[model samples]
Target: MRLTMLTFGLFAGPAFAQPGPPAEGPDEIVVTGQKRDGTLQDADASITVLDAEAIDQARLRDFRQLDDLVPNVQFNEAGQLSNVFITIRGVESNPFIVNRAAVYIDGIPFRELTNAVLSQVESIEVLRGPQGTLYGANSESGLIVIRTRAPSRDAEGEVRVTGSLFSGTGGAGIEAYYSTPLVSDTLAASLAVKYGREATWMRNRAAGVTEPGEIEERFVHGRLRWTPSDRTTLNATAYLLDINAPGLFDNDFFPQDRTLYDQLYGALNGGRPSGRYGYFHDAPKRTDETEYVLGLSVAHEVGSGTVDAAVSYRRDRSDSLGLDFDFTSLPTAAGRDDNDQRVTNAELRYASAQQQPLSFLAGVAYFRDDKDNQKSTFVGPGDLDSYVAAPVQTRSIESLSGFGSLRWRPAFVRDVTLSAGLRYDHTRQRAVQREGQLDLGGGSILYYTDARLASTDDAWLPRFSITWEPTDDATFFGTIARGYIPGGFNLAATQENITDPDVLRYRSETMWSYEIGFRVRSADGRFRASGAVFQIDSNNWQEIRVLTDETGRPVSSDFIGSSASIRSRGFEVEASWRAVPGFDLSASFGYADATYLYLFNGIEDLAGNRVKLVPEYDANLSARYQHRSGVFARAAMNFVGAMALDERSYAVQPATTMIDLQLGYENERFTARLFVDNLTNVRRFSGLGFDNLAFGTDGTVYGALEAPRIVGAEVEMRF
Candidate 1:
């Protein structure tokens, strides 16, 4: 398909322009996914590129808006800002396994789930296969690279305001960006600021609150660029983010037993019955978070090549209180969580010039992460005096890696290229969990086990690819790659009945992926198409599983462990056509068949089951019409197929289709737009959590509700 292009000449001139037909063939798209700049058509990998214009057209404020935009990929949010997860090509990500894929934002690596704010972003590249040969650990499935706008030499600024109204909720936001030169051709500075507040669709019935899930967020980003000479450049950046959300947790639980749930909560006086988006909780639920980041980078031209270096430091702190575990007003169980994390990263790399017939890239990287977490559960009142169980844990991890890649074009082979890359990583992790005694009230005390664990692991990842371009308009390629995810100790204490050491400290998981792809475009550049087919096999697949005692009774919290082997295969295709002047059409489709080859839970072998949270198929279609008079209208539809919610296939989310519409007018100085998202108001669960063991209910499921219909308008002005 024709990748969307949005160019804002922020430093030079006007920032807004009307869409029109290109004078010649489609625009050439450049990407830095390989640690070097190259055209997307020449890259031998599956990638999706979205520029700033596409991001604005879709109103993609956060990562969750990328649900159906890419093939073989899905984005889900588990009811909170820090609980987002992405599933790629049947490989699922959860709260425990948050780093199935790696994310890099402006040279900063985020192993854990972050807010992922998309304001002032220049471009985003989604690489669909394993990127371990370059990214190292935590990239077993895929990688996402985000590049924000850099400081420009010219002075420019913009201000934008937005408002939205959804079912039973509303929100408003504002953003501003400014860039100016400090010295002529020597130094420049840029700054961006954003603030927003929105009320979630969820309501609390027992508490008599209309909009309990209100959230407020603020962000500030600053950058300085200094060019000491024509051959060297230095850039430094600082970022801050703060969020406050009331009555929102990582996941909200609700009893699936309709008969029992209604019997317990339906007859309450002046209270509505609990449902998917409405709950019966009387306790105060709130979450507060803050993050600070600083980064610096340097690039220097060395004869026929360039050397690049970067370093970053980040600190995150969060506190949450009042989790109604029972999903009722009776206060049977409640919980709280507090977390802190600090991360430091550094990397140095060198790349040969791209014009040569042969080129090479080498890099070395180091990373360190420290985390402290505390979780507490209360039985009677939601306070420390009623604590039934509490656990405190601390973990430290360090990783070092070296990677290199080479690309060659043999003189004997016309229009063909070969590439190979490898990376070696060693990681050490140490953790301690202190599960102190629990007070069950009335002087009743229960003691739990405490443990300390440490482990060191190593991985050698490799990738190979070959590409052939017989004609300027057509390119074909094939690739094989290895991906890895490091192992770590579980934070939960070992149960008395569990004897397997693997449960306490899981082993690393690995995957091998094979793929072949082709991209073709019409001579006139009016039509473009791309297709790919791929297969992946995984060993030592890790997942969170509940522990049971000798009598088959539940013990402690769930822990990560190696579950089984998995095989996934999929194919995807995309096409875009400029039907006529000022009109365009684009479509994409994906299909995947993923299943477990061998699954054993220490008791029974359950194989051949479909992987959880993976849809069988997904598709998107869009049509747009733009007039020469600076007016445009667009319509799009997205479809997602049915998929199992859990490993046991107890619940399923049926197939769903959503439609969106947009109309706008734009000019050099002012722009306005009206949009409607999820026009049909399709309400379905995005994720599921089994709470049968925690609540002592027969098959109680805690579901994460999807967003409802939203109607919004936006206005922008440039100076």
Candidate 2:
């Protein structure tokens, strides 16, 4: 038996939805964050658990919207349809880097972070630390695990509609879910669908167009569950995502003084800097993407243990069109990218029953991914036909891993437990790139040579933990773990005119982490709190360095590199109190100090610099009230500290805060809510992007803005 967190039956907004009040004071919760089932308070890890009610109350539609809720977790999208960057505990990676944090949906891994939509999710677990022991490479920083709603024995259904308006633009969303039994207690099925559309606020002055930021999205999910006997069960799920967004508008910014802008552009582009943030040339911002996933899982009881198996396949495709170096209406610069990816994975696991003094588990997994990319750029002045460079690239990856864990409870130590885990992983990656024939403005074509490369890596990750419960209401734990990320060849290494061999491959990165944490609940179960402190020493930290020419000027070469060492230390605290019967308060605060210990790019010393995009401080506070009258309200705010946008600390984005409010009424059959996000209308940049080829300047930065103030209402019906 384990201690569980208490859940009050209250609907604050979206994140707070439950069937009904429990006969007890609060509902108990169970979590499976460590590949084993246990109460959250008993897990020896730093984790944030978002139950279905919490998720809905927060109105978190995507992972990006979940940033400030957890400590030391950051999410930023580059405004490209599917390119998203995530940093956990100051461990971050480049956009094109394949090795980083890992995202899992129902035990199936996904390459794209944005694909983890929240439409049909039952719960989300953010395990914030090195998870390499069980998850293997690329999970060196952390892991995001999503569990979708499972089929129930009885028929159930829900429908929700929401709409919002902000800055002269409006958005709407619709979602529906249904579940029913097919064969009484033996089989069941569930289906869910979601659609959303939003209008962009940025208006292009030069293009004489407004609402260029419009975007539409659709998602579908289906699942089936079959239980032939009490000891055997099988589940299958399928998901689809489709999105479209057209034209670029108000994504860039320039100097209000035309003279200064012109001079700067002239210095960078030989005539004038061609692009402005708010106004662009003839090009419209555009994005179109489609993704599909299918997965199956089976479990059976064998003697004193259980055997589990899972298999999955996924495919993703995207096409985009936008302006090139100059943001103007002229055909001078244009760019396009078409990308496709396919992935297949399989896993098998066996776990001993936890009722004994000793429990053990073992697993094996394999996955393969293949990708094809077609990227093109057209550069010429005011003509439809100009210098065009189109490159086609193909990449393939195969990974195999085996892992095991053991837990022991000694008879002498009445309430003490020791656990250990180890995992071995082997990965092989290969890529081929061919430069398209250059269509020189004239009637001639120049063909370029092709580039091919391959890399293979192996690593062993280990973990050890000890947990002690001195009293029924308090527990203490400590953990030490090792994490790894494999090395691989760069896709652009074989492109034309790249002379630096160092750009071809980067070495594997490893980290050793140490952590201590505690969880406690009040005697009356009215108050709960958890806290953890951790430090990590990272070696061979993968870094993307900007290539420079002899004159120390920036060049078009960006390659994978490594820093000698980097260190990150952080602490987090989360607490919740049920002050009174219908009132609740919760707060979370985190502080981190991450710095480059020893870094040299062959040109300069970057030691002592702060990691890019990792804020030093993050905090959140929330309060909710629910009455027996079926009335509820909540107010919450999140804060993020200042952070540097680049390695050199050349540019910095300031700290910002966001406030949200919600009010709703709920009963047995129906509920309605009104919400306001970004209550203060604070518009800030979520992240910075670098494109030397487009700006022709080394330090130039572009970024996407956070959404402005939004007011919306939602109605949900359940039957």
lDDT of 1 by residue, 1-719 (tens): 00011111121111111122433566766666667757777888988777787776666666666755777887765664546677788887776676687877766777775544466777778888899988898877888877778788999999988888875668888889999999998999998887888776666676544337777878777888888887788888887788888776645655545556676556542445666556777555777888888888888889998888888888888877666655666655566778999999998888888778999999999999999987766666554344344666789999999999999999999999999999999999998867675433223333546777889999999999999999878999999999988887665535343446766778888999999999988888788888899999998888666554453333444477676888999998888899999898888898889888877766666578888788889899988887889898989999999977766666777899999889999888888999888899887667655544334434445567677788888898988
Q: Rate the local accuracy (lDDT) of all candidates.
A: 0.74, 0.71
Candidate 1 residues lying further than 4 Å off, grouped into runs, are: 1-24, 115-117, 208-211, 254-271, 383-391, 438-448, 493-499, 548-557, 697-700
What shift in Å separates residue 277 of candidate 1 from its native position after superposition? 2.3
Model 2, stretches more than 4 Å misplaced? Answer: 1-27, 115-117, 208-211, 248-281, 328-331, 380-389, 437-448, 496-503, 548-558, 691-695, 698-700
- What TM-score would every model get versus the actual structure? 0.92, 0.89
Per-residue lDDT over 317-429 for candidate 2, one digit per residue giving the tens place of the 0 to 100 score: 87765544454444445555678989898888888887688999899999899999775555554322332446667889899999999999999988999999999999998
Considering every candidate listed, which one attains the maximal lDDT? 1
For model 1, which pairs clash?
A: none
